[model samples]
Each structure stands twice: as C-alpha cells, then as structure tokens.
Target: MLKDRRILITGGAGFIGSNLAEYLKESNDLVVLDDFSLGKKENLSGLDVEIISASILDDSALNSIEDVDVVFHLAAVPGVQDSIERPLETSMTNFIGTVKILEMMRKKDIPSIIFASSCAVYGNTEKVPVDESTCPEPLSPYASQKLASENMIKNYREIYGIKGISARFFNVYGPKQDPNSEYSAVIPKFIRRCIEEKSPVIYGDGKQTRDFVYVKDLVRALSLIAEKLPDEHVFNIGSGVETSINELAETIINETGCGKEPEYREKRAGEVERSLADIGHIKGLGWKPEYSLKDGIKETIEWMRRSR
Candidate 1:
C-alpha cells in the first residue's frame, strides 16, 4: 500500500510482475516495461497504468522510466533450460539489460530498486539451507547472469548510495502462472494435470526438495521490503518449508481429489539435489510467509480450475 508513489516494474507483464502490479496498483502510480518475449500484455488487462512494450536494452524506452521513485527490476530471460539452450541471448538480455537499467537509474538518480535475483545463484551448493553468506557457484548461464546483475546492483548501491535490495526468490507459484511454458515450475504443471485427472510428471526420482513460496506471500513480503528499505539488501523469500517433488505431486493429487500416482522421469541437469533457503536475513526485515503450503496449494488449485 505505498501511496502516491511513482513506481516502475520492469517485467510487469510476467507472473510475479503482474502479481506485484495487482498488489500495488491501487495505491501507487505504476509504469511497466516489458518486451513481450516472455511476458504477455493480457497480464495487465485489468490494471490502469502505462505499459511500454519494449526491452530494457532500449535506452530510449528506459528514458521514459525517469521520475519514478522506485524500480522493481524483474525483467529477464527466466529458465535454466532456456539459458543453456541459448546462452548468448540469456547473457545479453539478463546481464546487459540490468546494466542498462543501472545506468538509467544513475542518470535518473532513482533512489531505490527491488531486484529479482534467484536461488539459482546458489547453484548446487554442497550445503543445506543456503544463506546470503554462501558463495554462489552458479551452474547455468541464467544463474551466472543473475549473479552478475546482483553484483552490479550491490556495487551501484555502495558507490552511489542508492538503496538496492536483491530478493532471491524460490519456486514461486499461484494464479496467472502459465503452465503451457516449457520452463514452467512443478506446482502449476502438477495442478494443471490434476485438474485434467492426469498423472503429474516427476523428474529425478521425485526426491528433489524445493522451497516453495506462494506468489501472494511473496508479493506481500516484497511490498514490505519496498516499504522497509532495509540495510540488509539481499534476502531469501521462501516458505521455510522444503517439499520434495514426489510429495508436492502427491499433495496436488490429494488436493484435487484425484487418486493417481505421479509419473517419474529422469533427473534434470543444472538443478540442485536439494534447495532450501536460510531466511534469517529476510526475517530481520519483519517479513514472513503468510500462507501455509496446504492453503497455498488449495488456492492454486482453485485458481487453476477457474482459469481453465
């Protein structure tokens, strides 16, 4: 509920960006810039705001973002598989686009930014519950680019006195998540399959654990971070509960009242065996997950059913 503030969300047409737009639109004057490569305009259908359908790499387009108080930089090429398949494009857009955004912020004297980083930057760390202290050993091109952007943001903060918070998001899911994408996460896919009474597909023995954070909870946390402007810039946004892929599939089936087992497939590459977040840093900001995994799943199922 940040009122009377001029805010800009870079990838505001994507799942997380659209959700953030919904959460903040009522109180703030919002502007969104997205190239429509991964984000769709329909995501912003109901909102009253200015939409600039252009890539962040376009300097002229970025000039329009001047006079904004805060920038929620969420635009990027988002996936390990996609990054692997197209490393040059991923690096070009994710890294260069961020650098360009930083340059624009410097030119515009933008005060604060909430950057959408990733747990993928932690990569296959040989530790449980990865924290901000963990050295990022990125395995994919996507993760490397994200790390590069985080470093840029941090450096900009240190040198320019601009408050920048890099939120490392976990497996985010909810309504408006496009299950049709090849790079979509497990929850949306699972719920979609369960709605159709089909077996959810599981990869890598289904024992791979992930820290799932509901979209609503995440946006709430993000809004809190934007409000707080904490000194601790990097924080992990997660549910603090780790659920394995098999258990997640089973939960989806049960939630949908489907008595079906998940279909298991070979493990994927460039993914950690277990992924969890040490949220001690973010908790210090007075943020917490408001939705339990069960309730979140229920809401997600309801959304999937309605959207279909």
Candidate 2:
C-alpha cells in the first residue's frame, strides 16, 4: 500500500534520509526537499531523484511542494553538541521547523507523517532499556525540542486526524554518514579516525553506553511502521543491545586495524551515561534489526575505506 504513493523525505540528502530515499524510490514516487545545511548533495548522486533545495521552515518552500501522500520529517539541526552551541538555531530548525511541517501537512491534507524523533529525549534516565512508558527527561535543548515536536505531532493526530508517528532513533550509523561533520556520531567519527590511523577520541571515562542501530535496519523499520500505521504514535528504534564507548572504540580499532590507543577528553555536557531501548513495540509492528554492531561496523568501515 505504501508503494506508488508520493512520498516527501525532508532532509533527503542526509545520511538517513538519503538511504531511505534510495530504498523507497524504486517502489514509491520519492521527492526530496533539503536545505543542504547538514545534508550532502553527493549522497543523492546516481539516483533519479526530484530535488527541492530548501528548508522545511521555508513556508514558501514547503508550500511549493504538493501532492504528497506521506512525509518523513528528517530536517533538523542535528546533534547534542551542536545544539549546545546554537540553541536558537536548533530550536528554530528542530522545533519551529516541525511546526511548519505539521501546518503544511494540515493545509495539504496529507493524512500521515513519520517524524524523526530521538532517544536523546530519554536523557540520563537510569533505566537501561527505557520504553515509551518512561517519562522523557530531556537534558539538552535538542532533546527538548524533539520531545516538544512529538507532543505537537501527537496532538495533531488526536485533534486533526493526522496519522503522525514519532520515531525516536538511537545511535544510527551507515555508509553515507559524514565523519567530518563537527557533530558527527561516535560510530562514524570513530570509524573515520580509525581509518586514518588516528587515535579515536573518547569523551570522559568512555564507559557511557549507547544502543547503536544500523541505518539499513532503521530504514526497514520505518518502512514497516509506515505500512501498519500502528495504534501508538511513539516507538524506540534500535538494537536492544548496548555497547560502551570504550568497548565501541576497541571494536572499531580491531575492525579497522587502526591505532590501538584512544585519547580521552571531558565528556560533553548533557550526554547520557547509558541508553538502551526496549524494541517490543517496534517489533510488534513486524520489524527487527538485521545488522549486529560487529557486522554493521565492518560494513561501515569497508564503505569508509573505499570512499576515502
């Protein structure tokens, strides 16, 4: 049923968005709208994609695109550290931008939308495998913005009848991820540093753990979730397993055969010490992560090595 539908993937030139676009474009009519702030144009190469170079906050830009059946809202100023330095930009793009998208959806009468929320909303909760029932305690401005967006989306679903699903992503990594980005995730940054034979940098004691979900797995889960339009609007998308930063660095080093040592820096503020998701909800939607961290990291390193 999702096939042949006209889909809009905002931030479509980005790592996750581009991968999702590549996977769906073969089956669905995919239109990509991106401002190219964090997204890269090269990611869209070799694919016959309809590209609209603009921000989701642009009313004129959002208004310009029409006839959309479903929208995957991936446009935002991403990352915890990035948001810390520029709260206004993060709030504007992540929160205000989501409002604009929802308004556009309401105006266009697009009945369903999939928003890119984050597990960062869980904050530093002691619960190892936090579920949707766990109250969100967002520590950073970015996390707060995502939570606020989720509430607005849920409100729209109730009052306006929009099938809005908020997907709270864990640490995601894959081929198209930009390691050079100032706010790059640990996996991609670690992979690139390892490939360059540079010692991977770890913030703080390096024991802070994260549940890493492979990008392809996330893309598949999003597709399955879209097919069902599940009863609940919130889901934690990740591998149920957790890996510590120290262990993660070790694995990356062994995989890439890069420098064996790692340098430790002060842990960035608002970083959760531990985060793992209970995937029972998403699993009931008929999807599970196919890639293990080891396997996923190997593939990621292979791609980075080749691309470099």
Candidate 3:
C-alpha cells in the first residue's frame, strides 16, 4: 500500500524480512541490507530489489545507504538460546546494530522506522495476554536487547523527532524459516521433525503456550504501520490465540500427515512458560491476523514439502 516510497529493510533476506520484502516490492522501491551471517541469499530469490551485502554494524555500510522513506530493522542474532550462549555477539548485533540503523536513519533524514521487536521482552508473566503497558521482565540477553532497542527508539523519537514504531512480535513461523539451525524456532523445528516422521522435541512439559502469528499476517501489520503511522509507538503483533506446544506439535503432525508424537526434554533456561498477545491495540487500527493456526500450519507444511 506504500506506493513510490524507497524503503530499507535491515536483515532483509531473513525469514520475516524477506516476506515483508515480497509483500511490499510491487509498489515500493526496496533495498535490502544483510550480512548473510544468519540470512540467506536464496531467500531473496524473486524479489527485484537492490541487495546490499554488508553488516549493520559496519559504519561505512550503514552510512553508504541513503534511505528515503522508512526502515524496517529486522537484522539481529535472533534466538534466545543464541543470546544466552553468545551474549557479546547478540548484544553487538541486536542492540548495537539497532543503534547503527537509527544513526543511519537520522543522518539520511528518514522520517519513519518500524522495528522488529520480540515478545521475549515480557519474559514469564502470570498474565495470559501481555500488552504493551505490561512491565518488561526480560529473562534472556536477547529479550534485554530488544527491550533496550525499544527504549532507544523511544528516546530517538523524543529527541530527534524520528517517527518510530516497535512491533513486538510473538511466535512467528512460516515458509523459509530454517529448521536445520540449532537456534531455529520451535514451529519450524517441529514441522521439520513431523515431515521426517521423527518425534518433535519439546523443551519443557509441552504445556507452555505461545501466540503464533503467521509471517504473512505480520508483514501486513508492518505495511499498515507504515501507512497509518499510528500515535502508539509500540504494538503487539500476534494471532491473539494462545496455543500450547503440545497442541502445536499435534497440529503440525496432523497437517504433515507424519503421525509422530512430541518427545519430552528438560526445560531449557530462559524459556517462558506462557505467552499471548493483547492485540486489541493493533486491531483498533483496523488490522488483525487473517490466518488461523491450522490453516497457517497447513500452508507451512505445503511449502516445506515443496521445498524438499
């Protein structure tokens, strides 16, 4: 819906970033900045956009790009486990990398920025549906970094008059999500195991819940944010549907027709017990996820089957 605008997507070749690129490319002049450390070139297959293969941390690389309209900052060391094992790497990229992007935007005079924030910033809470106003209790380095980035964005908005919005993403899963990586998300891993007819590994008792938002739906929310530029700076982008891991595994197994059960394992540290998004804020802006869990899983399974 953003027409004739030159847009920049940091980590533009990653799962969510690439999907956003595909969604917006028809109307907007798009530029993707990625280091390919975690992102893949193959992900940008059919997108007709300029690809800048450089680190967000590179000052020269960040400065070289003169972006016009807005920035979708999606580049980062993306996993909680990765942040735990590689705190320095995660902080440098997720936290410092964001600072670099903001600096570039400021220098280039880019008016708007939509940040790819995570729901991990909420940590484990007794509340079923965590909203933006909920006090942040970041449990992992990754969560802390996202929280810090959100704050930095807020400060920049106040000081520099840059219009910034942070979309606190819940569990996002869909096509192109790598299941092979050690730091891969649970849905992709579960889908991969289901396709292989192997037991999907469950890190806990399998009762921990999460609100999964389809990647396509999330990109739509991003587009909406770009177009509307709503007053609220932060919005929770999710399905507003709380589903346990056990239910998710079952859904994937059924969708893939793999008929494998989930294998229980010791609960990992820094893992949240439950999560659901209070999406009322975003919904008020005339946006809500269109995909249900079963449908989204079926689509993801089909994509995986074809990719193999």
For all predicted structures, in order, the TM-scores are 0.97, 0.96, 0.97
The model with the greater lDDT, 2 or 3, is 3
Give the Cα error of residue 20 in candidate 1, in Å.
Answer: 0.3
lDDT of 2 by residue, 237-267 (tens): 9999989999999999999988569999988
C-alpha lDDT of candidate 1 relative to the true structure: 0.89
Query: How well does candidate 2 score on lDDT at residue 125?
Result: 87
Stretches of candidate 3 off by over 4 Å are: none
Best-matching candidate per lDDT: 3
Q: RMSD of each candidate?
A: 1.2, 1.3, 1.1
Question: Lowest lDDT 10-mer window, candidate 2?
Answer: 266-275
lDDT of 2: 0.91
For residues 36-136, write the lDDT of model 1, one tens digit per residue.
Answer: 88898888998997999999999899887758999999999898889999999889899999989988999999999999999999988788888898999
For model 2 the local lDDT of residue 175 reads 91
Model 2 / residue 75 / CA error / Å:
0.3
